[model samples]
Target: MRRTDVAEAWLGVGTAALMTALAPLAGATLAGNVGAQLLRDQQGWHRTTAVLTENAAYTETAVAAGDTGRAEAMVRWTAPDHSVRTAMALVPTGTRAGATTAVWTDAAGRLRHQPMTAHQAEVLGDLAGACAAAGVCLVLVGGRRVVVRVVLDRYRARAWERAWAEVEPRWTHRHA
Candidate 1:
């Protein structure tokens, strides 16, 4: 508990905490940027209302799970060009025929996933950043501990050599 040791300990703790906190912020920023890029790329996609042509079908297991069961149904929608298009699309389970839902389509009237939302980007960024930070902290802490152990071992070896040198002549009854 020397002053230097106390100071070093505090510094290590502060640095670790700072790294952990900073990683999430960086991650969030990165995620937001990526999300924005996705939004930009999603330009020219058309959003239109689609009508379900049949009852949405879902797997029995998925329905039994009580989740928003994955379901697909035939849907019909007019493209931006004013031409009617028909295709199979994912829909909420139990949606009956004639129900209308919003969908995104490319210029050729092909279905596409929507752009990344801000909230989704932030969450993804936070998770990725936190995991990365944790990995970095673990590696640094482990490396530090290993180095400290090696240094302490070297000190102990030197101390032992000196102590043995002082006692060797007396123990052997030979004055140097």
Candidate 2:
């Protein structure tokens, strides 16, 4: 073949090979993204359930306190099964008047003395209110508790939108 003809043939062959190789790569990437999305969805569902369970625990504590017509209090932990287990005792009415009360519990559920700050207590009270209003739970460990109401139904669509934005560019480049 002439030089120009041979060059054209080589270019066409390279284009065909690239296209063939890219097709399977695109398919594999799509499958991976789908699998990742499924896993994310499952995790989001589990988190939502956990939040709901925690909210219930907060409500229970509030109700128990309210029923006694005094400032009753209890501390609970979220179990692995998404259930709240009471970890501390209920302080009855007419106890000491303090801005913050700290009740520490050991791994064996034994009560230990803790000194909580007023700010921490106020934040917990706000979280409790938010949980009761939103029907979701909030658990604070060392700092202020802030509940943003990130329910699965409320944020799932946004999460999927974000996931798509992350995946789409890769997908377009692969296909192109």
Which lDDT values do the candidates have, in the order given? Answer: 0.74, 0.42
Q: What are the clashing pairs of model 2?
A: 55-137
Residue clash pairs of candidate 1: none
- Model 1 stretches astray by more than 4 angstroms: 1-45, 48-55, 68-70, 74-88, 94-102, 105-111, 150-176
Per-residue lDDT of candidate 2, residues 75-161 (tens digit): 444545555555333343434333223344434434443434445545554544444433211112111111123333245467678
* RMSD to true structure for each model, in Å: 5.5, 24.4
What residue runs in model 2 are displaced by over 4 Å at the alpha carbon? 46-176
Q: Model 1: which ten-residue window has the lowest total lDDT?
A: 1-10
Per TM-score, the best of the predicted structures is: 1
Q: State the lDDT at 102 in candidate 2.
A: 37
TM-score of 2: 0.24
Local error of candidate 2 at residue 168 (angstroms) = 55
Error of 1 at 111 (Å): 4.2
